[model samples]
Target chain A: MSAPFYIGYNAKMPPATAAFLRRWVVALFVAGAGVAVALAGLQHRYGDGQFEFGIVKSFDGIISESPYPNLIVRRPIGTDAKDVRSRVLLVAPGKHGAQELVRGLEGRAVTLQGSLITRDNQSMIEVRPGTIAVQAAAVAGDDGVPLGNFTLRGEIVDSKCYFGVMKPGNLKPHKACAIRCISGGCPPVLVVRDADGMAVYFVLAGSDGGAVSSDVLDKIAEPLEITGEVERQDNVLVLKAEPGTYRRLE
Target chain B: MTLAYQAISWNRQKRVYDTVMAGGVLTFLAVFVVTGLVLHSEITAEALLIRALGTGAFLLLNVVLSIGPLCRVDPRFLPMLYNRRHMGVATFLLGAAHGGFALVQFHALGDVNPLVSVLTGNTDVQRLSEFPFEWFGLFALVLLFLMAATSHDFWLANLTAPVWKALHMGVYLAYAALVLHVVLGVLQAETSPWLVGVLGLGMAWILGLHVFTGWREWCGDREHAGATADGFVEVCAVADIPENRARVVTLGGERVAVFRYDGKVSALSSVCRHQNGPLGEGCVVDGFVTCPWHGYQYLPETGASPPPFTESVPTFAVKIVMGQVWVHPRPNAPGTRVEPAKIG
Candidate 1:
C-alpha cells in the first residue's frame, strides 16, 4: 500500500568471521559434489555379462524309413538324410573312383570322410569327399489284377504305388483305396501256403472297392510267395497282379 | 517510540515466521517419509523411516529459503513464513540421511575402500563426459551444515549482522549447486524422464520467483529515481505541526522521519535498520520514534537506542522559516544535528 521501502542499512562484521563461514560453505559444497560423482561412477562400473552360435547337434536321434529316391532316412542329429554324417572330399564330377564305388552299391547308401568339429558338446563331421548310390527296379502292366490266394511276385515299378481296393457302390472310391487301385490297377494282395502245394483263398476284394471284411482281414500277416510284374514310377516300386500270375511255391 | 512497542512487533513477526516455517517443514517431512517408504523396496522399515526423516529435513530447508522472501513481499502471507530456519535445519538433517544411506549401500562391504570407491567406483574419472557431480552434492551439504550451525541467535550475536547475513546468503549458492547436482548426476544417470522433469520444474520455479522479484525491485527503484527529486523533500508547512505527530518525507532515495514535538521539528532516517520497518509510519509515544515494522524505538532527538539495543540511525539537518519545513539532503550524526527545519 505504501511506497515500496528500501533500507540502505549495511551491518559491519568482523572480516575473520565472514571468511571462516565462506570457507565452511565452500567446503561443504565440495564434499557434496564429491559424493554424487562417486555414486554415479560406481553404478556405471559394476552393473551387469552379455552370449552368440547355434546347436550343432541335439542329443535326440533321427528316424528314417524309406530308401533311395523315396528314402526317408533320418540322421542321428537332424531330421533329413542330407544332414547325416558324410565326408566332404573334393573330386571331379566324372571321377571314376567315386562313380565305381557308388555303382557297386546295392541300395541307397552314402559314404563320407572329413574332419569333425564339436559344438556345444555335439559332434558334426565336415566331410571332404562323399558318394551316394541308388538301385533301379523293373516295370509291370497298368490293369492286371491278381486273384485271391495267388502267389504274386513283381519288381517295384513305381515306388509310390498304393495297393488298396475301391468302394462298393460309388464309382468314386475312398482316397486310400482308389489310389491303390488306379496307381497299380490292382492292390498288392497277400498270399499264404497251405499244407498242400495249392493256392487257397487267403484275402480278396471285389472289383468294386469295399472294406476288407474281418473274415479275410485275419489272414493278412501270413507269409506266401507272390508272382507279378514289378513296376517303377516316380522313383517308386510297385507291382501289378494278373490272373494266374501268382503260383504257390513248392 | 518506546522500546516496548518495537519489542512487541519484533516478537510478533518472529513468532509468525517461526511457526509457519516449522509447520511447513513437518508436513513436508511427513509426506516425504511416507512416499519414500512406499517407493523403496530394498530398505527395511527402520531404514525407510530414517531416510524419510532425512528427506524431510532437506525439504524443510528448501521451504525455508522459499518462504522468507515471499512473506516479505506480502505480509499477508506471513502465516506461511514461520519457522523457516527450523525447516532449513530439518532439510540439512534429511540430506545427511540421504548421504549416509547412499554411503552404506554402495561402500559398506567387500575389498574396495569406501572412500576410494565413492570417488572412483563407476570409473567416472576415466570417462571424460562424466563430471564431478558428487562434488556438487558434497558442497551443498557442507553449505547446509554451515547454515544450520549458525541458525541460532547465539551465533547471530557473536558473528554480527553483516557477517551472519553474508554467510546465510550461501543458501542461494548451495541451492544452485544442489540443483546442478541433481540434474547432472541423478537425472543424467537415471533414465526416467518423469522424475527428471519433476526435479527440474521445482528448481525452475524457485529460480523464476527470485528473478521476478529482483526485476520488480529494480523497476521500482528506477521509477522512483526518475520521478520527483525535490517535490517530496518538503516535510510540512511550518504552521501545520499540531503536537507530537511525525511526517514521512522522501527525498532523492532517502526517507526522512520528521517529527514536531515540544514545539520543534526533528528529522531522522525513516527506515529501520532491522527488517526495514518504517520509522515515519510509527509515532512518538514518548521522546522516541518507534519503527512500525518491529517497533525498534529510536530517540527522536539523538537517533540512538535508549539502552541495550544499541541501534542508531543518521539524522538530517532541518530549517523552519516562514511557516515552511526544509531539510538538507546530507545526513548528519544523531544528537548533534538537532536543528529544526526553517519555515518559509
Candidate 2:
C-alpha cells in the first residue's frame, strides 16, 4: 500500500494517518502539561506581603502632611520602648496618597475608616472615601531620634503598592506602576536590604525634610546608592537625602 | 478546494485538529494555574493569570514556528500543518489576554491613560536592564493581532498570496520582540537559571529545525542540476520518480515538480497558489495534484484547478527522451496547459 495522504476537505483521513496523528496528539498534550508544570514550578517565590482587601476598621490618630501624608497613633499600653508611637502611612482608595483627604487636618486629632496593608514592620492604611472625622486639635512635637548619617544601597518603590496593594510590586515589572503611584502623590520609599535579604523601608524626603515624590520619579525600581540621614519617628524611618545625589549603581 | 469563502471550511480533520489544539491549551493553562497556586499560596490572582497566559502564548508560538520545518523534514508531520492557522489565531487570543490583564493591573488605576502609560512608563533606553520592555510586548501584540485578524481565506484571496505570505512572516519579528519582552521584563526580576535555560532551549530548538530543513532542501536542489540539451534540461529518469509521485528539480533558479502518473509524466510549478505552500512535497491524489499544506488541488497537465475552483500554478513543458525526463527552463503563464510526456 502507498503511504497515507491527508486531504483536509475530505470527511475522513486515511486510517494510517489518523492513527499516527492520534498517537502524536496524545504525546503533545502530555508533553505540554509537563512543560506547564515545570515552568510554574520554576517561578521565583512571591513577596510575603498582605493587603487586607475589603476589611475596614476605624483608626484614631494625628494626621501629618509634611514629607507625606501619614497618621500618628499612640501605641497600646505595653509595647516596645524604642518607639512609643506607631507612624501609620496613609493612602487614598486608588493609586494615590491621602493628601487630598487630609489636606487641612495636620496637627489635628482625627478618626478614619480604612483597610490595612502591611509587609514586615511597615504598615499603611487605604482610607475609605469620606470617612475622616475631624476632632479637637492635639499638641504635636517634631522630635525624632536622628540616627547617624550612612550610605545605603537599595531600590526606590512606591509606598502605597509596595506595602501590599500589589504582590511582588517592587521590581522592573512593577516599575511603571511605581512611577504612576509616586507621580500621583503616593510617597516614594527607599528599600534597603540587610545581608540576609530582610528589607528595611525608609520614606524618602528632600534634604530639607519635604516630600520628594516628584524628585525621585525617574529613579524608581533600580539599584540606587543614597547617602542620607535616617531619623526614627515612632515606627516610621525617614531618609533625608537630595534626589540629585542618588547614584545608580550598575 | 473552496469555490467561495465561508466563515471556515470546517472538515473532519480540522475539527479533530482544533479539538486537540484547544485541549492542549486548556491543559497547559489549568496545569499552570493549579500548580502556581499550590506552590505559592500568596500569589495574587492578576499576577497568576498574566504569567500563565504570557507563557502559554510564547510556547504556542514556538510550536507554531516548528510546524512548518517539521513538515519539511518529515511528511508524517503534514497533518499538523493542515489547520495551523487556527493555532496562530489561538496564540494571538492568549497573548491579548495576557496583555490586557497586565495593562489593567499595572497601568489602569494610575493617573494617565493605560496605553500612554505603557509607552511612556520607563524611558531608560540607554540602559539595558531598565529599558521599557512593555513597548516590546505591545509591538508584538499588534503584529499578532494583524496576523490573526487576516487569517481567513477571504483576506488571503483579497490580499493576494505573496502579500499575505509576507505579512504573516511578521511572526518571526513578533517572536523576536516577545523574546526581548520576557528577557528584559520578567527575567530581570525573576533571575532563575532554570527559567533562562528553558527559554534558551526553545530558541535553540526552533533555530536547529530551520537550519536542518534548509540544509536538506539546498542539498536536494543542488543534486538535481541535470544536463541541458535542445532547450530542455534533463530533470531525472522517469523510473527515478515513484508512481503517482513527483521528483522536484531546480532549473534557472525556479523549482518544478515533475510528476509521474499512469504511464505519463508532467511538470508544474512547485509553488502552490495558496499561501505559497511547497507543491513539490504534495502527492498526486485522484487525478489531481494536492497541496500538502491545505489540500489545494491543481491539474498536473494544465497546472489549474478543476472547474468551479480557480486556484492554479504555472506549468513547465516536459518531454521524455530515452527514459530520461527533460523539462524546459522557462515557465508558462499560470494555468497554461502543456502536453504530458508519455513514458516508454
Best prediction by TM-score: 2
DockQ of each: 0.01, 0.73
Q: Write down the TM-score of model 1's second chain.
A: 0.69
**Interface RMSD after interface superposition, each candidate:** 30.4, 1.3
Clashing pairs in 2: none
Candidate 2 lDDT tens digits, A150-213: 8999999998888778877889999999998998889999999999999999899988889988
Residue B253 local lDDT, model 2: 80
Candidate 2 CAPRI-style tier: medium
Stretch of 10 with least lDDT, candidate 1 chain A: A164-173
DockQ of 2: 0.73
Off by over 4 Å in 2: A76-83
User: For each model, chain A TM-score?
Assistant: 0.18, 0.93
